[model samples]
Target: MQFYPKGREQRLSIHHPSVRPRRLAVLRAAGVNLLLLQFLFLGLFCYIFGSLFQQSTHIHQVNVLFVDYDGGAIGEAVRDAYKKLEGPGFPTIIERSASDYPQPGSIEGAVCDINYWGALYTTANASNALTAAFAGGSAASNYNKNDVLTMVWNEARYPTVVDSALETTLKTLSQSARVVYSKVNGKQALQNLDTSDSTTMAIFYDPWTLASTNLQPTSQGSRLIYNTLVIILIMIQEFFYLGTVNGLYVQFKLYTSVRPHRMAIVRFIISAVYTLAGSLCTAGAIWAFRSGWQVNGNQFALSWAVLWLFAHLNFLVLDVFTVWLPPPYVPMALITWIITNITSILLPFELSPGFYKVGFALPAHAVFQVLIDIWSGGCNPQLYYALPVLFVYEILGAVLSSVGVYRRAHYASIKAESDEKACEERVAAAVLQQQEVQLVRQETLRDAEDSRSSNEEQETRDARPRRGTVTTIKDQEELVDIIRREMSRPTVESPEDRRSTTGPSFSLPFTE
Candidate 1:
């Protein structure tokens, strides 16, 4: 069979069975499988993460205990404050008497110890007691260690609820405490007392301040999650594209003389259409889900559009790499992973090293940054910046891939031509060799005939009688009969006999 070289006639149809079905099948399969897994995994991740965030805010309400050492007006104020802070979803605050110092059994949660300073206990006096307790035993030796223990328990839980409320209550508490202290002690006496002496004054101090440091928790935002999803989406696109291309390549190589470029283009077009469809399907799914959850429509639309663009750009880049590079899809996967990792898709752009800044120039990085902004609700100048970058990337990738396709097609054409030439050369060589062998056989037969003719001629010459020899008859009657017979025979051989006798002699002639 002759293999036709790649030409206008040898081009594969975009609608060819081998080209269409295999490409569509691979894409459809990948899209369905990946979409299912992507949604499932994303949902599970969101659920778990949201749950953890909510739980972290409720850790304080699990177990709480409160105790009151002073049952006086000052103690009542603190108790009332504790009551106002307690509720159904909050920790149970239990009040204990001084006699119950050890606090029977176990308190379900944390314990709070409130104490009051009497008139006898001045700022200097309380300071001496605190100092003495830390120093050698003195009158302060009576300072209840249990009370200190209970105070530690109170401090532990204070920040959990108190810190959350302190910002709203601080000013009011300070003003009210000042008015109360002024009425209890004349203004002149209050002025004479050290204003800095917190122990001597009725200053409302927010204990929660000491325990709570305003710190933001480290967490993954929607943008980060979205970026990760985009990475997976791109990976899925790569898989589908590779599968389709590989399938088409094998089928075309085995069955047809189509150029690689034509096949690539066919596959690319099919992939583009399939990808667009897949993107729409994925978008629809997301929209449906969002609608079911009553999520913001505008935000969902924005996110979906951004994601669709990301997917498109990703598909373009993947097509370029897959079409240009041959076999072992691992290289493509590695390159994709490297690009995504450096693009701040896996981490924050600011957190990334200076070396990775180049990735920011990539479309994927811009897309990822835009996604983060949209998810986190912030100003994203990159959204506009990324559009052009992505457009450039898409254009470049498409052009390069098209060039690769053309080159591949040319290569295929050249290769087919070379193969066909080689086949023809082999056939011509075999035919020429057979002809030369036939010629040699003819020469060998001619030589053998000449040798046989020469031997026969030598025998004929040897068998001939000498010129003077005479013949004798066996009997008189027989001799007369023989002479009569010889006389009756033709005097000379006919022209036919002469020609036949001499023909064999020269017909078997040999070369020197």
Candidate 2:
């Protein structure tokens, strides 16, 4: 009936007819192994992110909308010049009709919207501008304002690469045209036999010039914006992972009774703070390395706030995801990895097909733009764009967290009440069954007592002597003949009413 287990194995493996054996099932049954799962998840992200920048290039073939409103000789010459200067990596020049290019009036819109990198428009009087420049000072006096070439661009787009390419190409094209014109004009003067014209011909051919201006940053290219973005992202992710230590510590404390939203909030706070501190320290280190770390008040504040938002959003999302996802660490790390790659932090976004929506949706790309704006142009309209994406994570995630808490807590309370009520019902049923059993025992005892009393009364009746007319049978044989006849004859069928009389006429009743 009883067995005492002497060892752990026997206790753990206890098996009986009434009991099922307990065995350790797989780890996933109880949810993921947190330590292994988290390390592996983070390690995967580190490896992927660390290697991403090396494989990608900022330079890609840009699509330029080339518009020539000027059908003049200079415009035609410029087109011919562009023809000879073509290759794989060069901007693919697509000549657009005035109707085809729904060009934004400004260059900022072009690159900010990322529809096109740049637009080239030559003015209507380019040839006249060139001819006026060829004329002497008295003849060219009124043409001072007549600019030939017009170049406009989104200053924020590939600050170093795009601008450098455009600048270098324009200068080379202009200088080449100037040299050609000088040669042609020199030959024309020699053939015309005009010595005075030869002296004036030294005023180089058709003063070629490109007038460039930016729609956004009036100036450009003091730093590598993408490099800085990548560095910050690397540091941010590093600090983000570091904060997981604090997150786990806080979460362990919170495991007892923290609300889901509160947990998410706390996690975000810890990460954002850690990110800010680490970023500042990293900035200090960067400053130390290259003390030209321009301590622009606006730049530092905006960068800090933007980076903090990204870090905060990262933790908030992970906190929320941990609620339903079985392997908690994987979703966080996997999503972070995806966001990093799709942010187009390494390569130009246009290079990746269908990257616009995905890239912009990612927090990384937004933060990068915010960083660029801060680093170069104080605070700009780009900050307005970046903040909303973070706001979505904040507003939507907080709402979800609150709902998650409310629903789970509500259901838990309901389950507890149901369980309590079920226990009370079971107890009440047992008590009722016991009370019924007690009543049944009392009824059974009473019935048995009544039956015993009836049996005893019958026994008493049997023991007692007959009360009437039995002495006549005790006298003589003839007198007893009545008893014998009564015994021999048939008895009456009813005791209540006598239907028939048998042999003895004399009344002789025998009782025993």
lDDT of 2 by residue, 1-512 (tens): 34533332343323453344222223333343455556666765664454343322322356665666666665566666666666543565566664554443533345445556666666666656545444545534444322666666655555655565555655555555456545545454345332355323543434546666564552423346444454445544744574465355444534335675675456456556776776576444433443344446666666666656666565555545644444434445545654454445544554444433466666666766676666646323466677787789767765665564555556556765776577556555555565566556545645565546777756544542232123222333343454446543644358535534344332111111
TM per model? 0.41, 0.51
**What's the residue-level lDDT of 197 in candidate 1?**
46
lDDT of each: 0.45, 0.53
Clashing pairs in 1: 63-109, 64-109, 64-110, 65-109, 65-110, 65-111, 66-112
Mind giving the per-residue lDDT tens digits that candidate 1 earns over 1-512?
A: 44544333566776898789877776776676567556655655553343334432342233333334333332433444445555433333344544544432222111211121000001113223333333323333363322321222221111223332232232233234334433443444444444454433322221111111111111222223344554566557656775576566644562246655665567667666666666666656655544233235675677667666666666667666656655444353444444444344443322234444566676656765564445434323355677788778767877776676666666767776786677556555555565566556545645565546777756544543221122111233344455446544545658877765634221111121
Error in Å for residue 102 of model 1:
54
Which candidate number would show the highest lDDT if scored against the true structure? 2
Model 2 quality (TM-score): 0.51
Clashes of each: 7, 0
Query: What's model 1's TM-score?
Result: 0.41
**Deviating ranges (above 4 Å) for candidate 2:** 1-61, 65-71, 94-115, 132-146, 170-206, 216-222, 225-252, 257-305, 318-339, 352-357, 369-389, 395-512
